[model samples]
Target chain A: MSSERGRGGKARNWLRLFSRKSPPTAPAKGKRDATPDAKEARAAREARRAQANAKKASRPAKTMLATPAADGRHRICVIGSSHMVAYKLAADETTIDPRLFVHFQGLAGREFAAIEADADGIFVDYEKLLLSPRHLRPMWDPLTDAIAYDAFDSFVVVGTLRTSHILKAFYEWRTTGHFSRAYIEAGVEMLIKRDPGVNLGQAIHQASGKPVVTLAAPLTAIAVDVGDQAAMDEAYRETKAAIEKGFHARGLTTVFQPDETVLDASSTKEIYARASQTLAGVEHEDEERAHMNAAFGKLVLPDILAAAGAQQAETGAPRLTSA
Target chain B: MKNPYQSLPERAFWRPSVSEVEPTAISDVYRPKFPVDKSMRVVTQGSCFSQHIGRQFVTRGYQWFEAETPFTHFPAQLSRAYNYGVFSFRTGNIYTPRLLLQWLRWACGRDEAPDEAWTNREGSVDPFRPAIEPDGFASDEEMLASRNGMIARMRESLPSIDLFIFTFGLTEAWENKESGVVYPMCPGTAGGTFDPDKHVFRNYTFLECHRDMTEAVEILRSFNPAMKILFTVSPVPLTATATGEHVLTANTRSKSLLRTLAATLSEEHDFVDYFPSFEFIIQPPFKAMFYDGNLRTVTKEGVAFVMSHFFKAHGAADETDGDDAPRRRTVTEAENDDLVCEEVMLEGAAAR
Candidate 1:
């Protein structure tokens, strides 16, 4: 039994010699007492952290979100030229929220209806209105008084129309040897007096209180094939330029330009042309012009709607208001 | 080795006796952790996906601005072309980071004023007419100074942007001949007719793309030092590839390189981050769930998925009645098969 145990122990020792072993351990050392400087340093670091915390706590919190107004109603207003009225008239009322009240101001009713009915008659009437001193007096008076007016949470205006009309009136008066600078100045004075108590720089301030936006004009959809189309295009361009000038002068923010190119004039023309082509076989050619039979509207509507939606999202205000 | 069942110690195969322990409370799962208090102002820009970020921000009550947009009722019908100044800026889509930065500067009033002559409107003086006519600015310096004033105004109006989101789209672009400016598409596709002399094709290398991206980011950062960046690679394949390589191969190569570069850059920079939008859309499990019938365009469902994932990941998921809840519906395998076949047919038609 002793000899067997001896053989087993020898085998165990041989196995141990070939096997891997852990590293040798170091001798244990005695703990040193805490130093005064170390304690002081740690205290200082803690105090600094505490100071930072206190400073942070004392700072005013920044607002990341806007709170909705307590009153449910979100006021909005629209102000623009005749085209604006036309576009707004075409708008689907159901899409708009009931909480918002939209007030359509600017050239509407008879003035707009006449223009829609006959463009030439409307121009002639406008010329007569401008040439006659009596017609101008009533127009300027209301505008001036309304400029100081309130009761609007948001204002949507056709910048081009306002700008173009005023500029054209001023230009024709100056060139035709009819109205003096003093008269023009008087008209401008009335406009300034009527100025919506808002400027472009003040837009953000106003928007923060209640949103205000100026929309650029929509491009004309007249076919370029006609000679009058070129003239109309030029007139449209002039109108657009005038609107931009007016917006700049008033310091109002405009979302877009009314140039035909920007409005997808090519696509619009294509639609009209295609409709005309399709209607060539039918008797209702005029009906084809009135209605967009093709999906052209869909293609353009998305972009338009997207922009409008973006505007609404950005502004975060009601589209209309009523007191 | 000698005997299969020698009288070895029982300890060799003995397992520890099991003891029953009481179940822990579920409280651990609901334990509160540190809350983030810092208010981060993030600005997002890029391809269509950027709009997703903006929409999410608005929906969740986060601060964001879509500069191109203005307040209006008929948002669906708003003209995007005009909003982006595509006609005047002559830059379509503004897909690339560099152009986006440039656009931001223009929108914010940092870039020099555009030439008044370029836009011939009544009442506004054509500032560039002299150059094209009898007399104008004596030199480019004079014209630039005039333009600089407009830029200054734009700069002043810009709000301090904090975060920038960039999405990489295509590697191909066309350069102009006279002004040497880059156009988004070759002239003929959208507005400009194809002219060999005026429009030149450019297929940017990965390094070139990286350099441009880096430059754009740096420039934007210069405007706002605190601006953090999030880069995403668009998974949408090119509508058409100008590169001679097979369209599919070219798109894959382009997207892969861009994704790699974006990841590499994000790793290198502290402020820069990469979002897994590309992965989420292109992954096998998602399996073209984000694509429309055309396979190229994103469907509303796909947009919703992306938006949901984004909101969930960002911790901005709507908690109020779970407004964005998943809807459940059962469809037979036959219906699924038909849908798939229809999609395939549509995609084939679109490709042709």
Candidate 2:
């Protein structure tokens, strides 16, 4: 009998492997005449199990369905700095062009410097991206560590160049009349050369031999009394052309922020700037932060895809049509 | 009985001062007449070698005044290539005292700059400083505007300096024969044409150099009366000489004349002092160890040794943070040692 008891004790220990709570036992019969209380406890346990199973059934699997790999659409990889959060949120709410399947890969705060490119493809640290804050991670998981060069037909690089900064350079030069036009132009080139995003985009394009499009960082939402709208507009026009020429010379298509989103040469409309979100998914109303909301991204999406498609067309690739 | 010489210090005797001590360890070479503490705003200008002095002053945490500064937003390489922050102003290699006086005259509005501009397919070049812009200015107006801006900045900055360290570079220069305006280089070598009737080669005599320097100092004093002047003669020999004399003898004559004038000025003026940087490099006892393979460019070690003496005399040697001390090479040695000298173009001009 003692040997049989010892085997029973070992069986109980095996059941306690992942938990400290003892296994439940049948109520001691007739010890306290506790049949009614045992029935109540048994009913409580059954109700808790039912509730958990029901909650599990109601939750959607994987939050949303993954985009099928063989979907009949042109794939475009959208890589960028922290500003890709808007694009991801907008992509969720709005239907992207039916012809394109966009994938997002980004991290906040200059982490793009960690990315590398080679003949195989652009190597993104998938583990690092997954470990980042929720707002900085792509809503959809990247299946592979590296996005192979053949996996995408074209690329859209967001926030590589800040057009607002360039506009400021031009405005200062114009108002003060202190610097020569050539000097201002050279300064703009230096600014372009020094941006981390632009450097990465150049590397990716060179490594992959793929058509690429670069979008300017969002203009500041702060309202400014530029004193003279005409002068600011003139500076904006010249700066835009110079920046475009700079990107074109580097073999990337330049797509500026959509016009309806911005208020002036140096600022975005206050409405678009409202409800801007941080990389950690907090809504920020600060004007100086310079990030844009989902509305701005929604408007900018078509332009980005259009530029990407246009570049693909130039390279004589077959174009996909929306259903 | 002791004679007058018997009571002198060891430094006063040739045996103890020169023969006994090591060449590098030789001290008492300079005793500053006035305190040149870190608080003083110093401006340096002269020939190519003067570049090292200004840079060292800045590196040693001294207040080396820059009259015209480049845009801080740009990378230093781009700004440096455009010849900003290389000197007090963008007067590239003022190799002669006449050129220095000419720049001062323009800055003080005592004389208007000549309208002559050198133009080729590249762009319009400033005849005064032909190689100031890496590529010449886009137009004549652009070039003149830049030149005027420099002069304005110089005019505004001179009155603020606490000390002026000027190095004498060369006695040879080219000038407009009729107007007597001197150019930094012979016109044909850098930009303009070589017309015998228009431009004349001048190896300035000691009297002319002294007179021009005196007027330059007067103009500086007119701006800031309390500004102290310290003079140095560059030990760098000439790249080439236009005169019939051999390059060595020509260089010796040029250096000897400048050195004598430097000594004379220091003795005559209470506010002026001379430093023996020339003797430190060119003296026979040191054996020219400071020169590079070309025997012209000052090596990194040479510049460090020269600056060590300068800092030691001012009692600033102890004040240097190891991060910015002259011994550590933060900037590349090649980049630090190579001076932006337009005079080097004369070598290429000679080859052709």
Candidate 3:
């Protein structure tokens, strides 16, 4: 009897250790029931697992999808200085805008028309169209003509040349005691009031929230009279510094051209020798005169496209339709 | 034409559609709608290379509008550093084509010049002068009236314009929180001042960029009604980024997105076109074109190679039938002249 009592006691002890009433067991089909201590423990475990997963996903990927492999048809609109229009024509393959064939004078308007007609895309030659009596008839008011606001997909500003010119002219005028910072700021403000569409930040904010890309003008080619080599070198350095300053102030991106740098030799003679070989008899005889060439345009286009493409890839934007 | 049933050379092996899938370089596969030609008047702006394009136009006898004469007479070396008339002044930056159009409109007098403040005996009063250079009117009304007159003259000259060249430069910029002024450089760089209260850096997303660019195109078209646009992205890397990302990587990401967006938009819109200047330098087979010292910059020999290919592709082969095109211009003897330097008027204050 005593042995039987000891075995029962051992069995009872085992039950107490293992079972513990199964933590106030509830029906399997219904909600789980647990003591507060047990419930907290369960929640903690789940939270730990989630944290681990989050950590794993946060690491950067080994490779990024930046460039695309295929080529496509495009509808583009250009607005800016003479350089933008001229370069576009020199690099294009279509002749839709035959008017663009003229050299420099009407090039912006012609190119605008050609791209529009050839690609069946819209063209706004702000330099020509905005200034034209036909478009701005009765005058354009940002407060009123909302139709103008709905027309385009993008806006590109060649800020470098224009800003440089403005700055230069402002400085020259300043020297003559006519222009001041107040004048410059007022000019900027006046432009904003004239065309509500002129506010790039707002235009960007309203139009699918896209960002504006600004291009800085290139450094001027160093110019020289046939005889004064020293003066030419000094001029080149000084001008480059000034333009660089202007570009920096404007927050413009620069497409560094080959000629922007000083060549192997410092002698004005050597500089002239090198420059003459490339620019001899060009319409603009001075070396300091910087102009867009087919080669230069071709060289920079791909980089721009690549940069734009990478941004699109990151943001999950759709690729352009292939031509 | 012999036996029809005889073992034909596996016709199934070659399918016309399948053959069309041959691999091609992205640059060679896409063709711009507007062929570069002498009859086309060309305008270029944005970035340093823009000058190169302008020079090429002058060399080829194409009309390069906005070209400053007498100034062009400067030595080539100096000219590269003193480029003017290559871009517009209204927009302070040049990453997008849209800003270019807006500035153009302002310059052409299609829109009213901004109301600028000038400091005189009274201190910071609204000035009554035209915003554009070479002419300053007394009031906004006068400027607008003058702009109307200028627009008429520009319209008469419109027929001569044939091409618009725009080069994309940056993806990073700072915008004024209140005034909405977008600075080309961060406040601390160059001429701008670092005002934490006003300036904010922005690393724009691709979607935002595309929309801005697209709107720019629309605005441009509204004006010309028949203009062609050719877009190019600058290959230069970013000097800095506000995102705190690696500057190099940031540059790659920024440029890649811009390039892709430009390509996509060009494809989607008929009037829009894109050039492969980015590919001409960045991709392989063309890598040698950059200078040995700095891979970022192009060399004289590299420039020549690029120009050669460009001329060949555009059907503007050099007049000579030699192994290579003859050198167009050499550095001038008087390239270091001091009188020709671009004078900065606001040296101290402008540097703020």
Candidate 4:
């Protein structure tokens, strides 16, 4: 279903971050420094800080994601599951090249499965899209129910085959060490093949013969920031790498998570998740870490747009990049 | 006067055992030498029928040890497509005793698997397990790496296994003239080319089957002395025979030979036992009721009957029957009936 929501007006929901929950505050320092117990705690904290600094130093320098060339005009329609909420928020705040035009259209994750492709174009089946209480929210009202094949130069498919969903397989492969890397990767690919979002992207690409870029769901936040989380971080990185490789192998252009947003090796930084909300625009519970807020979305917005631009350019250059 | 024949159990008389009872109600068909319970770690190998056995063991809460497993996140359907969790390992239908011995040798480090691979427009296929990957492997190196990984798992899993169940599938195989290596199917049918000069058909004789099985069992014992063996002959008929004989006669001869070998092996080895799964389906009294319309694939009813006898013999409850059957649809009848068989591929060739 499409609606003419109109252009060039700041959306009312653009400033939704006010409802975000604040991140945990760091421990107070001045008064506790002189006490015996506080002194011991201070030494332990210093030791942990030193260890974390060493790890950060040892890690490779983060790569800056390349942006699209400002010369050519491009139209991009970003469609996907609930992760689109973050992108919507991020896109509004993003100052972009005058040549680029991007639009947002999607339902909640489960309901998004109702979107299907035919010879005409991609369209949402209203009857099949059943929304839960947590998923009830207004999606971008496009001009028509069907996304015409010729409407956009490229598409950005988001929130399909989330890395968090398949992290168990990654950990199992790491811990068991029984299967070959190729075998485990193939299994990951098979799981990716079953994702409704991935299938949709592939179908749209096949139908339109247009470039469809995919962005994996980012890792959720971890409970605690302390400890040598290098192993878990590495696992997440490796799993994300596998998912990206799998998507590329299926002929879909893939974009990695913004490296700066990732922390504790396996999760998005606390700052990005400070005011995260579910697709319903309700504030996320303290224990909830799967969905990130506007800040996280904002970080990823540029990279996704750049990917869409890369597909439009058809430069044949390798698009796989990480920070 | 008391005579030996008069004092025998009802099972010993054909009239009482066969004539008096319904085919489904036939009892006392098998008597296992040892007790099998949930605690024992059971590993299954051999033909397609053995898949049903391993699946039943896991669903019935028995310890069906999976030596090799796919990634935990792999869905059940995907794993099955890759031939994982179908058997204890990923070897796609060992089929014959010769193939069993070959796998054992490679796994035990007694011999190395040949580096030979079959190639098509898709990619390379492992000679030993051509159908293991639904899509052909990316390269020969990938195929070998996957194979070696599986063999290593087999080696690692053998030592800890408490029971080894092997089903005898076929009497015919195609062999490489030089290496004397037997393939699970005719080469060309699955992946490799069939050459008149290089690839030759082999209908393994009774002695040859026995020798191969005996060696395989010895290898298993060498790894774990306490491991027990259970043998069953698959009742599924030969889909097509390379031999000039009619397929029906070829199937009968092939099955008879395997059945005879199972009986002889079980009788000779104290650690080995035979289950009469073949007789349950093929016997005249059963009227071939266990077979589908094609009379080739075993029906779900047939698998249930065979498994019921095994579980009943072990004194374990068969939950697959009665009220619990509805809840236990994890392994659907279609999955149980759809065997990952290389031999079935020959039917396609014959159609041409």
Most accurate candidate by DockQ? 4
Q: What is the C-alpha RMSD of each candidate to the true structure, in Å?
A: 34.4, 18.8, 35.0, 17.3
Top model number, TM-score: 2
The backbone clash count of each candidate, in order, is: 33, 0, 248, 5
Give the Å error, residue A118, model 2.
1.8
Tens digits of per-residue lDDT for model 4, B140-187 = 887887788889888988999999999999899999999888899888
Model 2 chain A: ten consecutive residues of lowest lDDT: A11-20
Better of 1 and 4 by TM-score: 4
Better of 1 and 3 by TM-score: 3
Of candidates 4 and 3, the better by TM-score: 4
Model 2's CAPRI class is incorrect
List pairs with backbone clashes in candidate 2: none
lDDT of 4: 0.74
Measured against the true structure, the TM-scores of the candidates, in listed sequence, are: 0.39, 0.82, 0.40, 0.73
TM-score: model 4, chain A:
0.66
Q: What share of the true interface contacts does each candidate keep?
A: 0.00, 0.21, 0.00, 0.38
TM-score of 2: 0.82
lDDT, candidate 1, residue B250?
A: 80
